[model samples]
Target: MSTGKGPVGIITGALSGIGAATALEFARLGASLILADIETQSGDEMITKAAELGGTATVAECDVTDYAAVERLVARTTADLGRLDFLVANAGIAEQSRIASGDPARWARVVQTNLLGTMHCVRAALPVMRRQGEGHVLIVGSTSGREPYVGEPSYLASKYGVVGFAYALRMECAEYGVRATVVEPGTVDTPLTRRPPAVRALLEQMHPLAPEDVARALVFTYQQPPHVVISELVIRPLDEAVNADMPDAEPR
Candidate 1:
């Protein structure tokens, strides 16, 4: 759990965007990486990138929402790396729904992946962190956790849950020398964003932050001294303001 113990760091959704970038950044810092994702092609690329960076990288195709698979991921990481130092629960999804004609399926999928999947990762990874007596948990959340968006009901709900869970877990792990923190990013440019042009622009107008911006915050929080605990952060894009223009832009 202490710094420079094992080169092992576990990261999910590590094939693209912030997850991939964070993995490479950690490798650059001399940390061996274990990157997991559902996409084999992307995972392979990440593994290759880490290798090029002179850091060991292991890629596993894992769906965090799957309990058994996640369990295997933890077991494999421990088996291969000898010990686990950091657990980054970064896998998530986004979806929209309305009260009148709500897409139950989308809501369920988003909630399960973004919210329930996070719980699964934390639940499975806690035992190792507890045993190590020192570890860090970084969960990728969103500003929607605190500020609501009318169309993104499910995504907001899931992030809100994540923020709450991260704070609560931080308190629980303080005694064990393990820390939990949530990174609340706003309007990141990623595959998770699927909306009309106007809608996307409206969201940007509301508030926006890139995935790397959030990743920078994540690394900043994790790199802090052990005594310091950054419980929560809200990273917003400078381009996006709290603008309420373009009334006919889209219906929330």
Candidate 2:
């Protein structure tokens, strides 16, 4: 269950959704885990689940938007677990807003958590990856990030920024033997994606994907030979099509 170092993977937002799934996925693959989340109880629950798989899963408190906090997270993980190998920047926000009637404050929250948070994790994890000379980052993003989705302007923008982060960082980190990949998943069965009856019906009618589906993608990325970087993947539901007629986002 141990990598050459103690832990094999480090995942943020490890309390739920794709984050928890990825931790379990890696644990199933015999990888020790460092799972970070602000939610102590849920994070502990995740750690316990991984422990049942006979793998070590350490939980850390990380607010990815706070650079100092993120830095300390990586530093502490490395110190406790030894050499770090995999990092998943999977924390994000899901706020529904139309540009015309959007709350600027909500938009800011989305950008801060989804976009800047990814940046913070990447910045913090990159140094650990560099030292190892071999590391992989599987970023959790949304299909809206790849193309576009109506009614969620800020969410789209932030995920789009995540795509840019992975692509650009791939270029910068290639020489260091580090790989970056963005996994764009369609709607998953998570509290974040849960909705009212009408909204849930709409999403089911459109695109819907499971957390395990994205977790499979993460494991695939992990299994790849060090020579390749699986740059970007867009996973959408075959049953759904996105609407593009919605008005563009207006300035807040």
State which candidate has the highest lDDT: 2
Off by over 4 Å in 1: 1-6, 194-196, 199-208, 242-252
Local distance difference test, candidate 1: 0.77
Candidate 2 ranges beyond 4 A from true positions: 1-7, 204-207, 242-252
- Which candidate should be chosen as best, given TM-score against the real structure? 2
> Model 1: which ten-residue window has the lowest total lDDT?
242-251
Candidate 1 is scored at a TM of: 0.89
RMSD of candidate 2 to the truth, in angstroms, is 3.1
Q: How many residue pairs clash in each candidate?
A: 1, 0
Cα error, residue 149 of model 1, in Å, equals 1.6
What tens-digit string does per-residue lDDT give for candidate 1 at 170-245? 8898899998888887667766563456556666555555566777788889899989988888787776554322
For candidate 2, write residues 138-219 as lDDT tens digits. 8888777777757688888998888887888888998989998888887677777764344565665655677888888888
